[model samples]
Target: MASAVLYGPLFLQLPADLVLYLCREHLRPASAAALSLTCKSLFVLVFAGTRPGFNGGTQRRDLQLLLEKDLGHAPLPRRRVLLGSGFSIGYRSVRLAMNRHFLGAPNGLPLRYFDVQGISLGPLRWFEKWSARILQGELFLSARRTMCGSAWTDEALRAALDHEGPRYDICGHVSMSGPWSISNVTALHSAAVSASTSARAPVVLVPCRDLVEACGRCLTDYTTTVERRVRPVQGGGVDGRQTMEYWFITITSFHRLGSGRSPWDAKWQAFGGRPSISTIRLRRDMETHPPGAVKAAWDEGEQAAVSGHRRSHSSPTWRAC
Candidate 1:
């Protein structure tokens, strides 16, 4: 019998159409990446199209249409808001839009803000029917575990907090099972500030309250503490440089039961319980500072920094409930 012949270099000379077919039919993303490194000829042939077998202009157009069609039928991102009492308020289909200013702001600031324009809330089953829409553009969702411990410890939550992406909102659902305390609320405020600083985006916290009696207290305390913490400062900089203002966080509370209903009203009512909803607007009086005073304070801070001792500012103090 004749010895088997091997054509090493000749294999790379295979028809481009055949190579494209093999890659499209057999290769997964990982496999395709590996195949791209096999040889220059195969690489060119395999990747000739933007997507597999889409090299020609007509073919590319057809592929683009197919992608659009598939995406049109894709499911929108849905988030489940569960209360600590084992009752689910419902899933929200987030509808976000770019806003010139923060929600309810008088004028647009230099920073970017994406408003949570509206949210579709209803029975869990209702979300299934509206699966075709894309609810979020570039957003992150953090849901706390109801069993025990804090939500800040979750890895995904931490990463989302630290992400340095374009202004993307961080929406969090916090459910507390244990007794609510000032400490828990403080931790949450700190986490929101950290996330706002890291992502340069506003955070919207939606807390699920199980304690009907403590709902009002929690809302007041949490809102007040966060407002004070994120309040605009007149000064505090090194070497006379202007201090950049930090982003603000918005805390949305749902009304337990009343003549007025929030978007989530139906869902909360379905669970046979009233939920607390409050809109606490941050006082604008503390929102701005006199330019002259701000400049003077920074100059003073610079003088202090130049001296032997540097001044240390304390964290915002809050009264415990």
Candidate 2:
């Protein structure tokens, strides 16, 4: 009786096909899910025919192709996967967000894809250290002065910037087993060489200031000859000191050769064939900018500099004339 009343002339006013089209084209995933739960008739109309491998012939095939192209792959079978409901849409949204945040693309699609290997000293641990440093209030005044300009002299901005550094307990160093420590230049070079031979993708090594300086000192001492480039920028520091910082990066890529070379030979040759090595030297006073603006500016500047460098040095080596 209830079904007859619900599906009578009122529901029949709109064609079933039109309703399905509107849901598919106009509604968000969450809204579509909610609409499906409204009544049995709607649920059958939307999802009943679209079960995995259940073919609606040409229409189903087209939809599958579109989804694969957009989302990269089809959702895994429900019983086989641990993800909850709406996994496909959720994954797509997260990927889009990450791409926008990191790559700064409006559509969140990558221009090119590559397999990149990175060696870092535990990203999470590094982030914790950075957060601790930021909260110390040492850079607050400088940040306010830079961002607010004349407004920084006003009482409000002055009050916001003026504060004492917080104290926290420090952890004792535990010499634990790790693949490679940032302090060891030899280990870093060895890892880069291994990555080059194992994969054709470029290898990126991120080390602390101490390790970077150590590598700079030992650049000529390495068994394999390594090329070096220095880019320096000046900025004001939290302690009111003007400092110049340099970025030291080593990029390794594989090349086709007539015969296989020894590990040492391979490492040296990795740096020879590359056209231009991309590196970034961030100014120390970046914290002075407004929230999110610093990162955006840095990314834009880095991309422009890298593109210009590549265009100017398209030859076999990046050395200056």
Candidate with maximal TM-score: 1
Give the lDDT of residue 37 in candidate 1: 56
- lDDT per residue for candidate 1 within 1-321, as digits (tens), equals 122245545545577677767766786544564566567657666676554443456544433322321122233333344321221222222221111111323221111221122322221110111001111211111111111112222433434323422222111222221132222333343464455554554444323332211132211111211221223235754455444323222332222121111233332232223333432321112223221222233335446555634335445669999
**Candidate 2 stretches greater than 4 Å from native:** 1-15, 24-39, 47-294, 297-321
Model 1, 71: alpha-carbon shift in Å?
A: 5.8
Q: Write the per-residue lDDT of candidate 2 for residues 1-321, one digit (tens) a residue.
A: 676677664554588899878887997554565666567777788778763333355444434323432333333222211111111112233233233334354434331221212222321111111110111111100000001122122233222222211211010110111222222333233344355543555333223221111122111111112222333335655565564333222311111111111212221222122222321121112234322332333345547778989999887657788
TM-score of 2: 0.19
Candidate 1, superposed: residue stretches over 4 Å from native: 1-14, 17-68, 71-79, 82-183, 187-321
TM-score, cand. 1 vs. native: 0.19
Q: Estimate each model's TM-score.
A: 0.19, 0.19
Instruction: Name the lDDT of candidate 1.
Output: 0.30
Instruction: Kindly report which residue pairs in candidate 2 clash with one another.
Output: none
